[model samples]
Target: MKYTVLSLFPEIIDAYFASSIMAKAVSRGIVEYRPVNIRDFALDKHKTCDDAPYGGGAGMLMLPEPLGRALESAGARQRFVESAGAGSAGRSSGRVIYLSPGGRPFTQDVAVELSREAELILLCGRYEGIDQRIIDTYVDDEISVGDYVLSSGEVAALALIDATYRLVDRVITAESLEEESFSGGLLEYPQYTRPEIYDTLRVPELLLSGHHENIRRWRLRKRVEKTLALRPDLIRRGEEIGLFDGETRKLIQELGGEG
Candidate 1:
């Protein structure tokens, strides 16, 4: 899959892409990414991308011309102009998403949905926000990482990328992805490593047992227990989705969770 990010601050994107699993994935060609600077598409000598709102507002609003051109360069549309010898897809496009506080709540499901796309163009808005015309013209969806606001959308874009990329084939082991929090509507069971004893507390005995069956059951029970303890809402939703089987349901009941 290819990910194209349109941001005024490409440096932020660069730092993240330069390290860890993202770096390895890019090197192996398992995933491709390109960061396009919104400023690069600015039209004038001042290289300005934002201006005061027409009706007036608290902060400057990003200009439609620069942002529209940036999205065009990022593949929001198929049309092209010859100045830079580029097309609407300066990179490519499967979906165009704008990161904003007023967008759909982003979740693991959304990450899974995006990971299936052949390409994704992420727009990171700044200042007051992008011109509405840009969103109406090119955006397929708008997504938010959380209820709170952040200084820049690049941070949110990186978060969306992190959640989606790890699910891509060859990015990580399939088992590693499946056994994680939110994988099956439940938080993952706690994990422990060497140094069995820490702060006078020992790792769970079941995890140490060589018996695989008992350990598996223990993990499942603990998964339900933890979800119920920390997020009963998830337990309720999981039950509605039939995410738990008969044994798991029984386990939830044992933990005082409604089936």
Candidate 2:
């Protein structure tokens, strides 16, 4: 998948794309990233992209003109302007996303949904936030990384990109994704590495036994127990939506959960 990110500080986004597994993904052509500097679209000598809100606000808001131009440069078409024949070359393809605290919550499910898209254009707002007109004209989705406010939109954008890029095909193995937390409506079971004895702790006996069926059963029970204790909501939601299989439901019930 391709990600076109618009940010006043492209360096932040660029650094992430150049590091670790993300860098490897890019090298293998499994992922593509373009960080567009929003300030580059500013018309003024000072490159001003923010201004005080018209109705009075605590902080300045990002100006619409520069952001609009930035989005257009990233292949996003303004809803009304497209009819006037001013759309960019790939205007109809990329899904434009804005990072905002007021947007829909960004969850594992949402990441899975976005991972299926061929291209994404992420707008990283600054100051108080981007002008509403920019959202109204060009954005397809507004995603919130969390409930609390953030000092920089790039941070939120990076979080989103990290969650999504790893899920793309060939970025990571399907087995890794399948066993991860939230994959089956439950958190992952605790893992152990080599040196079975660490301090006073030892690897689970079942894991050392090399019994695949027994080990799998042990992991499933632990997953259900952990979810019930830490996040019963996941179990409730899974049961309500019939997301769990008979074995999982039996595990939940045996673990003293409603299932």
Candidate 3:
């Protein structure tokens, strides 16, 4: 997948893209990144990308022109190409997403959906936020990583990129996705390694007993237990989605869990 990120702090995105799984993906041509520096498109000598808000806000808002310029130069060419393949003649469904608080909450489902995209453009807002006019004119979507606000959108953009990239074909083992948290609307069962017993906390006996069916049962029960204790809503949602089966329902009942 191709990802174009527009940000004042392009270096942060650069450092992350050059390290870890991102670097490996880049090396193998599974992923691509283009970091566009918003300040580079600034109109002033000081490269001022922010300004006082029209309504007299406490903090400066990111100016729309420089950001719009960066997005246009970095993404428009790709949009044109994608538009041709889509045969739409004018529009590119290739997303130009702005990271901000006033946006739809990003989730694992969204990540999986984004992993299929041939290209994405992420707009990272700094200072207070970007001008609403720019968002209206250029952004395809706005996404919030979480409820809490951050100093800059760069970190959130990188996180969204990494999460989405990992879901791409061959980027990670398919089995890993099946076993991880949120795959079935439940937290993953506990994992342990090395020492069989630590400080009297023994590894679950079924796991070590070599009985595959019993281990599966134990794990399922524990998953329900953990979810009930920490996030009962997940269990509720899981049931609604048919993620639970008769065996799972029986196990939850055995553990005195509502679901």
Off by over 4 Å in 3: 77-89
Q: Candidate 1 lDDT, tens digit per residue, 40-144?
A: 889998889989988876998889998888877776773344467555543344698999999999999999999999998999999788888777767889999
lDDT of each residue in 24-130, candidate 3, tens digit only: 98999999888899999999999999989997859999998897688778754222224344542343445889899888999988998888999898999888898
Question: What are the RMSD figures for all models against the true structure?
Answer: 4.3, 2.3, 3.9
TM-score of each model, paired residue for residue: 0.93, 0.95, 0.90
Scored by lDDT, the top model is 2
Strongest candidate by TM-score: 2
At residue 95, candidate 2 shows an lDDT of 86
**lDDT (CA) per prediction:** 0.88, 0.91, 0.83
Quote the lDDT for 28 in model 1: 98
- Candidate 1 overall Cα lDDT vs. reference? 0.88
Ranking by lDDT: 2, 1, 3
